[model samples]
Target: MDVIERAVSVLMHDGLVVYPTETVYGLGADAFSDEAIQKVYEAKKRPLSMPISIAVSDFEMLCAVAHVRPGMEAFIQAFLPGPVTVILPARNSVPEILTGGTGLIGIRIPSHDLALRLIERFDAPITATSANIHGLKDPQTPDECTVSRELLIDGGRLSGIPSTVVDLVERRIVRRGAEADKVEQFLSTL
Candidate 1:
């Protein structure tokens, strides 16, 4: 089977897998599956309230999980499929656990072919966060991914940076990482 097929199978079975994107290796699972989503949090020892970003293959899928507030469409049209995470109001389609009891969700469409292909096939949001334990440096390569990760999808190498996080709900910059200026410009309109 191809990589996308394998990824869909593993995720469908509620298994967590490490995969590469433009930013870093991410531990991914079906975002809509509470059990699978919990595994991602537990595997990384991430706090339940910390929340995880959801990665999608297209804008339509993105809108399914998040409420596209005014001005969101244009921003997504420009910066998606790149290294940027846009936080938006979570729709009822998203689970409360994924939002940390908040009505917000961070979504992204990474600029990586394999990752995008997996998302397209899965046809559902996948929780995506840097493949690392809490309070550790983000991995820069497949080999550097968190030791606890059992499956690694080596996409050659990664940029060693993470997508810049912009909170659309709050209209502010949450964290400055890779592509800060680009993210800032998107957030500026809010």
Candidate 2:
């Protein structure tokens, strides 16, 4: 089957699929589906306390899940479709499971076309956590990704660098990544 159709079908069925993102291979599932979201944490052996970041294709979808404030637009404009993740207050539409019962949600529009297309085609946001076991080295290639019999989309090798994470709620820097310095600079402007 085609990639888009396969991706949508898996998400609609609340199944997990590993796909390429700008930083690494990510395990994606329906962000709104509790069962699907739990599968991601289980599959990766990730802690329930550590929330996963959701990927959106556009501003409209981003706005749906997050309470977009005035300064948020400037941040999105500067780093969206890139490697920086913005933590925003969640709207009622976002599931508590996705946020790990936290009011804040991490969101991003990746620089990768395949990643963006999957979100656009699926017509829903997806939990885009790195496809790796917890505390394990993140997979840069599809084959390296340790998925358990799920649909894996190979988009060649990915950059080993993960996205720079910024917490807007705390108005401070979180863990730094590939474009850490650049992201910090951008955040300072706001």
lDDT of each: 0.84, 0.86
Per-prediction RMSD in angstroms?
1.4, 1.1
lDDT for predicted candidate 1 compared with the true structure? 0.84
The pairs that clash in candidate 1 are none
Query: What lDDT does candidate 1 reach at residue 63?
Result: 84
Considering only N, C-alpha and C atoms within 3 Å, which residue pairs clash in candidate 2? none
lDDT of 1 by residue, 48-153 (tens): 9888889999888998888997777888788888888988999998988888988888999988998898888988888888888877888878777774643568
Scored by lDDT, model 2 comes in at 0.86
TM-score of 2: 0.96
Candidate 1 ranges with C-alpha deviation above 4 Å: 147-150
- Taking the tens digit of each residue's C-alpha lDDT, what string does model 2 give over 59-118? 889999998787778877878889878889999888887787888899989889888988
- The TM-scores of all predictions, comma-separated, are 0.94, 0.96
